[model samples]
Target: NTTPTAVADAGDATEKGGVANGSGGVVASGNVLTNDTDPDAGDTKTVTAIKFGATSGTLGSALAGTYGSLVLNASGAYSYAVNETNAAVQALRLSTNTLSEVFSYTMRDTAGATATANLTVTIHGANDAPVLAVQTTTQNATVGSAFSFVVPTTTFTDVDSGETLAYAATAADGTALPAWLSFNATTRTFSGTPTAGGTYGVKVTATDLGGLAANETFNIAVSVPGNTTPTAVADAGDATEKGGVANGSGGAVASGNVLTNDTDPDSGDTKTVTAVVFGATSGTLGSALAGTYGSLVLNASGAYSYAVNETNAAVQALRLSTNTLSEVFSYTMRDTAGATATANLTVTIHGANDAP
Candidate 1:
């Protein structure tokens, strides 16, 4: 076989490897080939021969003469024209009939034209709910004291979307609530003063943008005060009698004689007297030495007493002589052995009852 050679006067080679004539290889009528439409002068007139046959045994055999010159269809599909000039083997894959064709096409070439298959995509819902976290100043407190705490602003969140949340707090027993209590919405904080004394149950619930909720509960206790009293004692030893009065005579009287006597000077408003009496001793009228008066009313000053006033009647008689006289009367006397001994008396002689 002889190979075709370019003539010395040929202008250029066509895409089919043919020498370019003056008008680019004779316009390629029927069996003629040309590169009149090629954008570059180096393009040749060499045709890309394609044969439609199964490349592997998995597909059926191909028809004889099913080889041809390659031509791109109007819809961008490829077609081969009949040709027997130079036979060649080529693989042809059928277009997929399922939705997987688009995937396959996309995987192979992302920039490829859209396929005619219908596609559906599914999306799943998020699997997260709101969460609640709690905090407080103290778990225990005394009555009428302050109990404070804070609920974090970010207490609840949607795990998938990360949206802001809302929340509120409630006391188990409304009657036992704190005296001064309030809540802040912006900061989600709680503060209050507990006026009552007892254990309180507190609960908080948080809600997310999706309306999902969560909650937490806790306890607080308050204590009460104690009791108080007083005590006293008396001093009985502080009360005592000072002393008794003494006789006015220069000599100590051996027998019961009329003498001035007084109660203890230090005696208070209330007084208690304790005494031992001697036996009776008296002297008759004008008698002097041996015996002394049995009884005497020497003086009566402040709440005084006389033995003659007693019902026993130990004295023989009672007498009062002067108003200002210190010794008013003298009666029978008593000995130490309690026997009547003597009587002493002084009788005044009046001149016909001197009335002046």
Candidate 2:
């Protein structure tokens, strides 16, 4: 009843005609019959159980012949293994209880009928979460501007294509999404114009059909537009001061805010003073007083103040001596780009306040 076939190739292996390759080490046998049977032999048959990557075992019962288990390990998909005892079968003890491995069996009838076959069994692991390319990104927008952020198709990826993946967005603090923004779970995007200028932080989570999840956070900065270049009121303004009097105690001193006096159209714009210089003077005392009559300078509110002494002889000599006094000065305001805006600051001094 002994049935023999062509010799098995010990080089290349397949499931039926060769041993399929595996990750964890596994003991496989030669390719033969899936289930062998013999006519004259009784229904009784022997099965050779070769544990390729077993954790622990007595190394008993898995008999191919009286010699030993015919489990020969080689680096080939197709290979032949003969029955022999003490073949030094290696058992790489993997740490986990779940892994995929192959088990080969050789069944022989009592009448000497024999066949070999193998099957793969995988000890599955817990489902895995998809991975994202970026956990955070920052984008800029202006108030009232159309704003939108869409997650790229490649934002989340899973090795298992069989598992369906979904996306959800929420506030990073787990409270709620930004007031001005809305999240689309299907598109994985954030949309809506920002109501005001500020920073909005959001978190997005990706979940697989298996319930495995991963998340990422994003930062968005919204600003008021036209702030890059601020505009202020007229670049020019005037201030006057009476001459401090040496004649009987009559003098003129005046103060004014140069900035508030001007206009600033840019809602979020601010003006700053960069430089102040007096120009050529004219009029009766203009030459003698010139830059002296008044000063051009910046105040706390980005404005200027002018003054004069009608009583002081020097001040009076400049104006009262000639019946009139005049002087001119120049100043520069800082633009949004740190540039400068030049303008004139005029001051007039009269002899009216001079001592009789």
> Against the true structure, whose TM-score is highest?
2
- What's the lDDT for candidate 2? 0.47
RMSD of each: 57.3, 30.4
Encode model 2's per-residue lDDT on 1-356: one tens digit a residue.
Answer: 66522122332211110111112333344333323444563455554334444422122333232212333322112233322111211111122323334555445565656665553433322234566654343456678888888888776765542557788888866878877899888877788988876556677888876576666665566656664533334443333334344454444544454455444455555665443444322111112223565544445255455556433455555434336565665544443323233455556555544334
Scored by CA lDDT, what does every candidate get?
Answer: 0.29, 0.47
Clashes of each: 28, 30
Model 1 — TM-score against the truth? 0.28
Clashes of 1: 28
TM-score of 2: 0.37
Per-residue C-alpha lDDT of model 1 across residues 270-300, encoded as one tens digit per residue: 1111111222222223333221222322211
Give the distance in Å from residue 52's predicted Cα in candidate 2 to where it truly belongs.
11
